[model samples]
Structures are given as structure tokens and as C-alpha cells.
Target chain A: MNTWEIRFAMGNEAIAEGALAAGARFYAGYPITPSSEIAEIASRRLPQVGGVFIQMEDEIASIAAIIGASAAGKKSFTATSGPGVSLMQENLGVAVMSEIPCVIIDVQRSGPSTGLATKPAQGDVMQARWGTHGDHGIIALAPSSVQECYDLTIKAFDFSEKYRTPVYLMADEVIGHMREPYVLHEAAGLVSRKQPDPSEPGGDYKIFDFERYDDHIAPMPPYGGKYIFRMNGSMHDEAGFGCGASDNADKFIRHYEDKITKNRDDIVMTESYNMEDADYVLVSFGCSARSAMAAMRLARQEGEKVGVLKLMTLWPFPDKEVAAALKKAKAAVVPEMNLGQVASEVSRYNERKIPVIGVNRVDGSMITPYQILDALKGLYLKGLSLKGL
Target chain B: MKQRWEIIFSGVGGQGLLLSGNLLGAAVSVIEKRQAVMTCTYGTETRGTFTKSDVILSDGYIDFPEVLDADVVVSLAQIAYDRYVDVLKPKTLFLYNSNQVKEAPSPARQVGLPMEEMAAQAGAPAAVNIVALGILTALTKCVQPTSIQEMLTRHFKGRQDVLGANIKAFEAGLEEAGK
Candidate 1:
């Protein structure tokens, strides 16, 4: 493993290489803008690495194929945009109920439905958390730079394996298309799913042993192996037999929530920039964080105290840390490519009196640093005073 | 750190400005080992549409990645030149090909060259991008000539079909930029 390999790579290509480095053995995706480059790179690189690359008919089948591949004991993934992700919601629900481990790389674009293919947006911030119906938790990580696109994709896979759940890399077109020189590490820190030892015996070995719900994990037996059991969407017992009892349904939801909610500390991650002794803060993630950093520099230049809280993991949102960071600020600004999706989330945890102002833009253009700086300047001037929050 | 310099190359589709921008970043950031960022956006039409790329070579971190204003802008076609001319700073160094463009934005900012014709004369019309890159490298002094030559050698090494002509055209650009 060469530790010093540097290349001028786009965000999408970096994702494919990162997936390879993380030992992803299968990929199924349909080429869509912003995210199409991931499929293109995977098609070329997966075969060389002795992995399987399947171009499915549509986004639904692409996710379905990866889910099936993951069940069959292969590290699998798929890439899509907002439109495709919308189609994947049903299958994603199916994956969550069955606890199938897989990765989804969603290069987000501006959209309610196919709004802008080439433009960038963070509109999917909430979608990554609540797109699937019913009580289910998902791991979604947003990368702010081309290098993080590589580093976080590997982390996405690791979390998927650790929790036996689906993980998402919610990227936008800005980071997906931008080229930057990055050096890939020799070996990535990885966590594999706990597998049941074959010598431990197949006799009465149940797949869904609920007795271990505190860990929110069960050693999944690969489909092709000798272990024989039933897997279904309906409520199931410890041995994975279909059950309709009220108690079992209650237990199912509890364990489902416990898997993610309990491990929030291990899963939820955020990066703060110049947060020490700052009176104003900017809560942003992904490509918007780049602009927010620039805004922080400008605000500091003007002798104003400002910082940034860059969220890498969108789901299992960090409420405690965010509330604490907002305590010092009279106002916090949320600048995103979308119209205030994450801004609303920031306010929920903002128990402090800090007024979180959202500077939004979804008109097929990126939100520049100047826009954020203007919003920050206007926030304290109009919304609050120094004594507020 | 040297004062941050930005370069944008604009031209018609199929003129290889994207590759030129890529190679320039490869030369300065990779070969010369500096901080660099590169991006390009183009219209839907494959040919006859305006395609351009921007590269910023800085000694340290690049705060804003995109080029809102540039220190040097190379315009290979009349339409692209006309579109981006007004977006220049007061001291921006403008490079244009006189064969494709009829006039300059301003006499002081313009550094006109017969690059397209020189490339065509070298029997590699597609090599005009390399010629412009060489001329920009010389005019801005952003990248060393040796690094540009190394990038060209690494790019066109396998295909002998157009190797000599591209190098010749780049030399012609370098010589013309000196005058």
C-alpha cells in the first residue's frame, strides 16, 4: 500500500476510489447528473479490483440489487441524486426493517423534482434522515471537500458495517465536480459486521436474537451459507420467525431506535472552526461550509467574533454540542444551498436564545461567502443585540 | 507566500481549454508543488458552445475556490473573450489570439498573440490550448517553463501522432509572448 499517492481528482471519482479502498465489493447504480461520475468511475475501477459493478434499469432496482448483494455477504453500494433517492425511499425502508448493511452516495442537486441537474444544493439534508417512513434510523455523512469525499465514504461504510444499517454520503454538485489534489492514506480504519462463527454450530442458531438488543446488533448470517432462517418486513421473533404479537412489535421499534439513538456519540460527528470565545457562529455543512469559513474570515477581519460549526453527519443530529456552541452567540447563521432545511433543525436544538438566521438560495447557484457575510452582519444588526442569547 | 494569482481560460468547445486548465494546475500544483484549485463549466452544446475553465494557484490555502475576478484570463475565441472581458480587474493581464479575436478589450490589458495560427501552422490546430498555456505561463510567470514542458511530455508521450507539433506550437507561443 503506497501511502503517498496524490492525484487531481474530482469529488465523485474520489468517492469511487474511497469505496474501493474501504473494500466495497459490489456497486449498483444508474447514471444521473452530479452523481453520474461516481457510476462512471465505479464501472471502470470496480472490475479492476475484482468487484462487481451492475448498471441496473432504474434507481429502485439499483438499490434493490445492492441490498440483495449485501444480504448475500458482499460490501455493496449505489449512487443517485434527489430524484433517484426519492424512488429509493421504499426500498430503503425495506432495508432498514431487515437491517441490511449498504452504502448510498447521493450527490444532491437543486430539486423538489428534477429542478437542476448540474447545480448544487443541500436540500437533501432532511431527506437523508426522514425520507423513509416508519421509525427507522439511518447514518448520513456530508463531505465538505474533495478529500473528505474520500475519507467520509470509507467512514460511511464502517458505520454501516458497525450498526448493520444503511449509510449515506450526502454530497452536492459543488464538491462532486470540483477537482482538488488529495493524498489517499495507505490503509483506512474499518469496522466489519460481527459474523457468527461457523464452528459455533447451526443447530438452533437464531439470526435475530433479541436478547442482545442493548448492542442493537445481531450477527447476520450470509444468505448463501449453511445457516437457514426467515427474514421478513413483518414483526419477527428472536429466531426470525414471522410474528404479529403486540409485544414483539413494541420490542422491534425499541431495538430499532436503540441501535442508532444509543450509539449517537459514536456515530454523530461535527467539526468546529475557531469556536473558542466567539460571539457569533455559523452552522453549516458540506459545500456551504466552505463559504461559511470564508465568511468567518471576513467577519473576523471586521473585528467581529464569529465561528462555524460544520456538521459532517446530518442524521442523529448533534443537539447537545450545537446548543452549547450556540450559547455564546447572539445570533447564528445557517447558509445552505437549499431554503432552510437544516436551518429549522438548528433552531430546534437552539435552547439558547440565539436567533438562528437562515440565508438560503436554491436558484441554481451556489451561496457565496459574500452572501453569508452579509447575512451575518445583518443578523446582529436587526435580529438581536450583544446582550441577547 | 507569493501574492495569490488566478487564471481563467475561455474558448469555444473542442479547443481543449479544459485540458489546458487541468495541465496548468498539474504543472503548478503537482509539478511545482503549490496549492491549487481548478473548475470548469460549459453549455449543453458539445461544439460551437462556450466552454471555459478557471485555475487558481496560491502559495497557501485557497479561501474561495471559484474565480470571481482573475489576474490573468486567456481568451481563444471572440465570443468567450467578449463575454468575460468585463469581469477583469484593473491590472488583469489579458491574453488573446489575434487570429480568432478581432480586437482587444483594452490596449493596456491586452497581450495579443497569433497562437491559433501558429498552432495551425505547426499542423496541430487542436494544440492551440497548449500554445495558450505556454504563453500564459511565460506572461504571468505563474508556472516555470520546465514544469509546463514536463506536463506536456507526460500527457502526449504515448501518442506520437501529435507530439512534435504540440511542442513546436508551444515554443512558437513562448517566442511570441517574449516579443
Candidate 2:
């Protein structure tokens, strides 16, 4: 619990320190590029804190081991790149359905089967939601700065523990490898899921309460605890028993969706810069937001009414906040490291019929502020021509 | 908002530009209590390919960490100079090593200084990056000269010779740039 310490560190180092600060007692992960630093740091530091660290044979085994550790009542996590995350998909799907508490780090690189290992791409934005296959709820946080890399890792763990689900920290290589001066704060407030009371009457213990699942998370009992139950991945009843009732299956999926979406007010967060009286709104996440901020500042200085909406939380898409920020703007320009993964989402979620333009760059080179300004300049002409200003 | 100092160090892999960027960032943010962000990106090349590091030194918080256009671009080799010459603004100060680079076809307002020769005279030819930092500090006055000296001493703690030679090279560069 070191506090008020200032040091120069990489983005990945900050994330590892953040996770350790959040009381993560177990780390089981395989090595991958741009993200191996998280595992390497955890290996050296976890033992000092009396935590367990293991390097499994492959990505699949690494995820499986963490899930088992979490079942045994340990705050666990694993770090991987695209290829490793792709390999951990099936187990990740299982974790999603079973509502296991774990944090997964996808330090994204160029993808589609062993692509550029060291180069960065935000190409996994869509994959983070749908990659696990079935219909389930997931919370993903995107950090743009080195400080947020630390802060958001704590947030990722908090959401996973509070909601009893797997969370993803979707960071690219630029944000993962970039170094800066960060003042380390006190340990974050750790959140652990509610466990069933061991002393409760045997007849009163219902581990998975179905109707209350919307507002109340089910109390999970550790494997060696007094309560006995099955941790099944398939469709199950309130007591964790196998069930073939069609109505019960209908209730299972609905509760999962409502539990997260009904609470999306707290789960989704966004950052808005100079949104008042803006003509063009720049929407971005992760490293792309940094360049967008710079471009927005430049446009303001030149007397152009441009603003930026940085999506700190990528999943559960902050629709209301985005619409509010762009209430006065004429259009939005989405700049992503990938080819408009979030841009497409913005266009779909845009309720005001505000034209959404996407500025995409995927060559492992960053989309500079100059590029964002170019997109806004094009939009400025369209706005002027329509209004005859 | 006042513009922050945007600086770029460009060279081949072995010239220690990345460490130079780190030293500058540490000097400003750690000792001087100003905000700074230093970034570096490299390909698979070890010695010959283009490698660059950027340092954004600001008085307040930094929103953007990357520098697309730089106020100063230091070129340690001929290829780096040629690669960056076309991108320089008329106001940019393009600094090049006189011994390593020969020609600048465009009018880039460059000052060809013998940074390598200055390092050689300071008893450590490997300290060219520090010398370049010294020149930048002396010319721009973005940071105090003593702060960079303190950072260099802390960065090379165990090797006394490395520390002393880099200090001498940095002083020589500062003196030359002042003249």
C-alpha cells in the first residue's frame, strides 16, 4: 500500500501495479508481445505480496487455471494479446456464462492469425464483445493515458467483482508501451463478490436467486466452503442444478442481460472535452483519443468549433452521455487505430441523425492530430455549405 | 493554452536516442516538477532502421502524448537527416551531426554541430545522445542545465566513468551551443 510515490514507468507496468493494488491474489498467464511485461512484473512482485503466480503451458491452460483459482476464492487475472485471447475464447465463454470473477488483459496487436506481433491496432474493439461466442454480458474498459492504465485496471477488477463476471482491459501497444511520469496513489478500494453465509440454515441457502438476479448478484460459495453446489456452465436453476425447463432457460438469459444493462448507468463512463457550442464532435477511445484531443485543441485555437468525446469505457456503449455531449454539434468524427470498429457503433447508436464520419488508420502507425483535423476540415465545409454561413 | 515544448530525437537504433528521450522527460517531470510524456516506437530493425523518440514537456497536464510535428528534430546520422528534412517547418531548428551528416538539400534552417566530435573530446564517444540533450537544453532553455546534469548522474549511477564522461560531453555541447 505505497502511497504518494512518483515514478517514471511504462503503461503496462502501471497496469500491473494497479491490479496488484486492487488485491489480485492470483495471476496465471502465458507470454505474449506488448503484454508480457504485465506477466513478468506480476511474477516478480506477486511473491513479495504473498500472492500466487503461475505460467501455464499455453493460453487455454492459463485461463483455465485462473478460473479454478477464482473458484477457490482468489482474485485472479491473466494477460494476453490477440492470438492468446483468441485461444482463450472458449474458456472465456465459459467464464462469461458461469459468472466467474476474473480480469482479462487484451493488449491488442495486429490480428487475424499471427499477424504483426509487436505492432499495435485497436482491431479488437468488436472482438471484445462478440469474440466469446454466446450471448452474455461483459464489461470492457479502455484507457488512453498511462495514469488511466493504472486507474482503469482497478476499475476493471472492481466491476468484475461487484457484478461477478469476467472483465476485459482493452489496451493497445502504444498505450501499453508508452512511458510517462505517474504519481502513484493509495491502493484502490477492493471489491469482492458477496459470498453465501456459511451459518445460514440449510433450507434457506439458495445460491442463485433467479428473480432477484436483476438487482442482486447471486452469492457464490467457494469450493471448500460449507455450502455444496455445482459450478455448471450450462443452463441451470437457482440452486446451481441442471434444469431442462424452457421457462427457466428463458429467465436465465434475461436476468444476465438485465443485471448489466439495467445497471449501465454506473457501468458506462465517458470523458468530454470542449463540447459546448461545438460544430464537429470527435469520438475516440484508447490511444486514438489522445490524438483527437490534440486536434480538438488545435481546431479551437483556430476559431473552429470542434470538441472531443473520449470513451473511457468501451462496452455497454455510453450512448446517453455521447448524445448529450454532441447535443449542439453538427457531426461526429470517429478516429480509431482500427478501421472504424467503434465508429460503426457510434453511427448505429447516434439518435440525432448527426452525420458520423470515421477516420481510420491500421498500419501500426498512429492517426496523428493532423489527420483528425483533416477530417474535421472536410466536415466544416459540408456544414458551411448547408447553412450558407 | 501555451504550447508545450515538442522535441524529437531521430537516428538509427544504436545511437541511444531512446535513452536520451527518457533522460529529458525525467529531468523535467521528476526534478523540475513539470509534466512530461516521452514515447518511442521501433520496428524489428536493430541498428539500421529508423527509430525515433518524442518528448512533450508541458507546464500543465498533457492531453496528447505523441508529437507529429516537432519544434526540434535532432538527426544523428545522414539517413535520419534526409528522412526528416522534408517534414520540418520553416521555424523548426533541425540539428544535425556535422561528422555523420553532409548535405541538406532543402532550406530547413539547420545547424550542423559536431556532437560526435564533442563526445570524442569528452572521453566518451558513446555519449553523443547526452551531448545532444545538452545542446537542446542550452539552446531552448526548456530545462535548467543543472537539472539535466543531475538526471544524468542518477541515470548512470554505478559506472562512474560513464557518468563523468557524459557530464563532460553535455558541458561541451552546452558551451558550444551557447557560443
Point to the candidate with the largest TM-score: 1
Deviating ranges (above 4 Å) for candidate 1:
A203-205, A383-389, B104-108
Task: Tell the DockQ for candidate 1.
Answer: 0.60
Candidate 2 residue-pair clash tally: 0
lDDT of 1 by residue, A1-389 (tens): 48767777788988988898889999999989889989998999899989999999999999999999998888999999999999999999878888889999999988889877777888988888889888877889999888899999999999998888999999998888877777777544578778886577865657778466457588887886777756677777877778899998888777777788789999888998889978888999988898888888877887777899999998888887789889877788998988898889899988866778898998877778889877866765784543321
Task: Give the clashing pairs for model 2.
Answer: none
Cα lDDT for residue B36, candidate 2: 88
User: Could you give me the TM-score of model 1 versus the true structure?
Assistant: 0.94
Candidate 1 residues B1-179, lDDT tens each? Answer: 34578888998988998888888887877787787788777754677888888888888877667786678889999998897666677788888888889775563388778887888887888798988987887677788888887878888999777777778877777777877
| Residue-level lDDT for A83 in candidate 2 | 94
Q: Estimate each model's TM-score.
A: 0.94, 0.91
lDDT at position A345, candidate 2:
81
In model 1, pairs of residues that clash are none
True contacts kept of 1: 0.43
**What's the CA error at residue A57 for candidate 1, in Å?**
1.1
